[model samples]
Target: MFTFEAEFFPDLTKTSVSEFCGEELSVLLHTLRRNGQLIEQLWNLVEQNGAIKLYCIAPEEDALEPRHFNRYGLEALSAVLQKSVRPPVFRVIGKTVGLSDACACENSEYYVLFSNFAAEYSPVSCGDCNLPVPLYKLPGENEDEFYALRQWQGEYKACDSLFVLSGVGEKFGYREISEVDSSLTRDGCDVCREMSQKCNRPFYYFLHRHISPLETCPRCGQEWGLDEKLHGFYAFKCDHCRLLSDSP
Candidate 1:
């Protein structure tokens, strides 16, 4: 992963952006995030020394290239920079050494999941290397690329967070997130199918089961347990349902 900084000298004297700074900046960040140009919603907005700097983490050093911007991202970026005095300057601040190495497999399967406990930015990960697959590397139409998948990530994260709290919403959140027949799982499975067809590779939908004892597929009621675990964690796999869960 690469850390990048975009510095802007907002001329508050000419056009006061203080009123719209928060709103406009949020829109810009969301636009970039949805397009997969930016990883996660995590960022730093700092104002110092007569400059406003936005720091972000990206999967690739060139992930913020102009060509990567969808129409909305472009417009948002322009709006934010219009408040600047001498245009905006962007550069890679540094590289990040993460827990998992970047996906390097030539032919690898994929799984889709998001955990509130993990800092994994991408919801899609290579089944072979157990590393994230940057959304831009996947096939999709312009502007709407990975649109549904990205939406699912946000929704899943919310549910995941609630489940982690383990309070009043725990059962509700857990069922919504991990149950195969739940709306969230259904939507995520649909996204996996679409991504699989687009990339011509297996895209499995991860079902979070902390200590499931079921030997049969929850959806199909057929045996799906593997002789040994796949990817060191997934002990059950249902090809028909495109689902995976850990052992009991």
Candidate 2:
């Protein structure tokens, strides 16, 4: 992920910056995020020296380009930026310190939508490189956005955060650990099925287990342990269930 800073200097000729910069700007930022144009919503919104500056993460250097935005996002951005003195000046500040190599699997044999509390970017990953697969790469009905995938990622992250927090989050912990049946597992499996059907490739739902290693698949009660760990992480994978899990 790349970090960028956008400075929106107030138009001195105008009495004040339009009200769009407040909540409307935030909505626009998230709209871009859901469209896969930005990695996350504006991380920082600061007002200083009569200017509003925003910081955010992007999947690529050209992620913010107009070509990447959905119709709604593009429109919202134009409406908000017009309120600035000039166009919002964008500059790359830095890259994510520990971002993995981006997925290069144009025709990956399979894909996995996997994310944890620590991961705030796209959950879909190429099975081959174990790197994030940009949401836009996957075929979707939406012209330029994978809003459904983004919504799933948000729900998954919320469940993961609760699981990580522990205590009084038994339901969340079980959801993460279970290979099937849990609401999270069901939702993730639905996403996997949809993607796989659309792409004509296997898409697996990664289930994280915090307990001891098991010799058999939890869902099917069959031998599913891989002879060699996949990506040195997934200890088990059930083709029938379209599920993968890491053993502690």
Candidate 3:
């Protein structure tokens, strides 16, 4: 059985709690606190089965320490444990319960459980790019959430450029542009000329320079390999997809 010891007023912030427990758990806790029946059921389980133990260091007025366990915090934690689906050995250490041993299972076992939970709960795709996006949540109004949101938003902004580039060649009835060819100077080619006219700007102006020559094939999602032709020009080809793009 997995064991967890949560201090009522840890030095960590609410954001840290969310990171430790994960976004799904944090959200579930938020949802459960709003419902009377669920919260009562959770407290009953904690009281009856020793599934959760509650303790307080010292109560203070006018200071809201995000780390400390309050009613909402307990409710959130209970909800998370219930939803985690794995059997957990929990004990609320109060003045009476006395200290108990840490979990009996090895650290590796806990790692596997949490890893499986994240994989099953994480989001499949980003909302903007439709690329894979990890499941994430902002649990509190804290700097941590601010930074996480900024990082996530930055990725979506970067994907906008990638999405445009990925569709450019196809939009012009040209073969999917290899990263190598796209990086080359756009001084020649009817495709570039047409693209310039369509965008009302030089095609190379919008091309991303950081694109790697070795890229995944748009058709088959397989790695593109370098191919040398008799004409001395280099090409990128994917054997699985039969997709080929000659270097300019």
Per-model lDDT: 0.76, 0.75, 0.30
Q: What TM-score does each of the candidates earn?
A: 0.82, 0.84, 0.18
Q: Where is model 1 more than 4 Å wrong at Cα?
A: 11-14, 17-20, 23-25, 80-83, 97-108, 114-120, 145-147, 198-200
The segments of candidate 3 whose C-alpha lies over 4 angstroms from its true place after superposition are: 5-44, 49-118, 121-216, 219-248
lDDT of 3 by residue, 1-248 (tens): 01123322211323343343345444434333232111111222122232233222211121112333445555565655544434333343333232211221211110100111112121122212322222121112222222322332233334444445556433321211223243221222233343334333332111222244435655566766474541233245454433344344
Indicate the TM-score of model 2: 0.84
As for lDDT, the candidate ahead, 1 or 2, is 1
Better of 1 and 3 by TM-score: 1
- Residue 241's lDDT in candidate 1: 78
Evaluate residue 132 in candidate 2 and report its C-alpha lDDT on the 0 to 100 scale: 86
Candidate 3 local accuracy as lDDT?
Answer: 0.30
lDDT of each residue in 1-248, candidate 1, tens digit only: 88899877777775645543576667878888877668776688887776778888888778888877878878987887776677777899888766344565666755555444455577888877788876666655545657788778878888887888988888888888778889999998888788777777788888888645567899899999899888688888898978888765
* Candidate 2: segments with Cα more than 4 A from true spot: 9-15, 48-50, 99-101, 143-147, 219-221
Q: What C-alpha lDDT, on a 0 to 100 scale, does residue 3 get in candidate 3? A: 18
